[model samples]
Target: MPGASAPPVERHGRPRNGLRVARVVARDFDGHSETSLDPDLRVFVSDLARPYGLELREDLLRRGVGHSYGEMAEELLAQALPAGEPVDLLILAFSSPDVRPGRSAAVHLSRFCPGAPLAFAVCDQGPAAAFTALRIASDYSRSGACRRAVVLAVEQTSLHHRPAAPVVLPDRHRAVALVCEQTDGDEALVRQSSGAVADSAPAQVRSEWAALGPQAALISGPELALGPQAALSGPEPEREAGLGRDPLGPVVEAGPGQPFTGVWTQLAERLPAWRAERRPVLVADLDRRLGRLSTLALPAGVAP
Candidate 1:
């Protein structure tokens, strides 16, 4: 929200990188409470054996993770927008189920964005939905469809599936909002894929990058398992314990959820490092549920 005062500029009357990224902010659930997964989903949790503890059935519930979807999303947008700056579009990428029945949540959240920006939600796309949203944002910005855009990704782990059905439970509640306009910055959406993988994804991404001829520094979700020689292998690092001591000042912390939000949150926190490196940043997210992968590239300092 720091540097959002100026309107986007066009070069030769065409949108330039000046339609750039403004802010990337992440918020976690207010707190947590010990709870257990539904008996049906419990078996799946037991099999994973992660964060396993205490009573055979009790699991930690990320309470207040999302008090109200619309409110939370709007608050995050406000946090990213400078006072009185209008957002031209709002893109909501969500992987979790909502208490409401339709995409009205996104429409309501757009109120916080001001300027009557067009808003919609991209759902059922799995964890990679955020990348999908990014691609959508890129196209809109590139084509001059919108000068100012906001991408919002929110995830909550509570399940509303059948009692015996398996469900994906996030470690915590989290949301990330990224502000975008046109810019000449190094960042730009390169390639994105969401099709079924015929072979190893690591190999696929590596091959794709090799063809493109630019070595990329990949920042990816945990799902894109990579090995040595893989194209800029992007693996989500474990969450750190302390935060305020970083050389770049306090680092934003990462909470739990689908790997998509986890990787995105971590990316937001690492903006300083990326800016220092002055290298390209590739964000790759995969939705294991749909066997889909979504990726996009950004230049250094895209977040700042």
Candidate 2:
């Protein structure tokens, strides 16, 4: 491990201002056809807005390409604050975006809520994005950059649908939001273990391997309710062999199930290590396809 690269450093320091979650509003495209409004998105937005005494605006609709991060941001902002008050923070969560090269949410925020502080976080698929937004808002509060923040997470898994292949769609689209406010009390969720493990870390290797054993189990789980195994096969023999040297090197690719299984496996094994190390961990599983969305948080009492 001597030459092993250290995990990327997180920006840790006092926040510029006492921050808090004021409100959260999110939307998804669920129960709606590819050409219709994703009902799940509307429900998500409604849930967050209602709790905070807000309502969804007609202008704020899910639109644009399936990759609608910018569109979602604009819609959420419009619905959350119809009167257009100056916002302190804005966080957008999405699985995909219209543009790959630029941060679509940031771009949209710049145009819609230009003066507000902005942050973006992605999650594992869509449901997880809501959680990611909460964490991002919490980080902002901890940083003291803002007093109130808006968080939105949306996902569209429909793109993965392939008629030729046996597909497992779990209500396909979901969106959620949270409003975070700075608090002097204890954190709602303690940060446990954070920092990225190298794609070569032993922990990472064990996780990927353990995942192979349970991939079938996940596909068969009643919660996920995926049907018979599709024609999809495991990774090529040559690729599978290469994984040992670089376990995180992206071998053994399959559907979403494989990567998710690997991450849960990693968390199950690593969380205990973190606890043994005296860290209170919160596991964040992000989109493997998007990369680096996963995070672990060790709470205040935990050791560095």
Candidate 3:
């Protein structure tokens, strides 16, 4: 009998709706030559705080390898929020973490916003990560979990750069934040997929659920390098030439590549057609050489 009827929606303590994006702040290694602390971070944070009527509460520096994505999220959340404040939603994005099986973002988030709804995804590019955070915030708003949600995407791309492979060097490292709220006449995006391929190694899937007035698509997979025919009809290609011998296979194989081309191409082809039908498209490549970083794709022209 317990399964017979729909549970009543909780109203007494539930989060409110119509959350609008309050603010967005981003910091990148735009002019830095090395990993030394960049002083412009304060300026960037200050700029982001202005539109939202908030100020930078703390200057927690995310450097080198001392912290993972989850730790970074925890530190930022602790500084931005006071203890016991009720949060409706939290979204964390990062390139790497201390462990694989245990997602640091979700875990650390639970500590500060105990009962708040949460969602997270990883990407190899900071912009992509920001896009993902925005979408997640929108989803939580639609679900009626919180009136406002906090979204963050941070990266240490310098870790993936190597002098020997100069072509593979990622030019920057950064973190970005956004506070989202619901608004009227705001359209939503929906994500549709058949799920992952059984034999295909893990690959990044950036699907845009909804955006302002139209839908968008951002695809980051390991298959960008493959030709159309090979990507579409070919069998799963063999793993990269040296994957078996490389110790970093786990991280190296995270983005789009030959094996993922089939799916990527399929989506790419279909997404454009969707856009032509009045949907705005925001697509980018989180190239394989960039290694793993959080990625996102937001509604075009939506002020970040």
Question: Candidate 1 or 3, higher lDDT?
Answer: 1
Name the 10 consecutive residues with the lowest summed lDDT in model 1: 221-230
| lDDT (Cα, tens digit) per residue for candidate 2, span 1-102 | 121112222456432333322333445443333322555555555555676666454443445124355554566567666666655676765543222223
Q: Which segments of model 3 are wrong by more than 4 Å?
A: 1-19, 27-66, 82-85, 96-103, 114-116, 124-127, 158-173, 185-304
lDDT: worst 10-residue window of model 2 = 221-230
Best by lDDT: 1
Instruction: Give the lDDT of residue 201 in candidate 2.
Output: 29
RMSD of 3: 15.3
lDDT of 3 by residue, 113-202 (tens): 535655556454422344455555665565665666776655543331112323222234444455555654333232212222222212
How many clashes in candidate 1?
A: 15
RMSD of 1: 10.7
Misplaced by over 4 Å in model 1 are 1-19, 31-66, 163-165, 207-257, 301-304
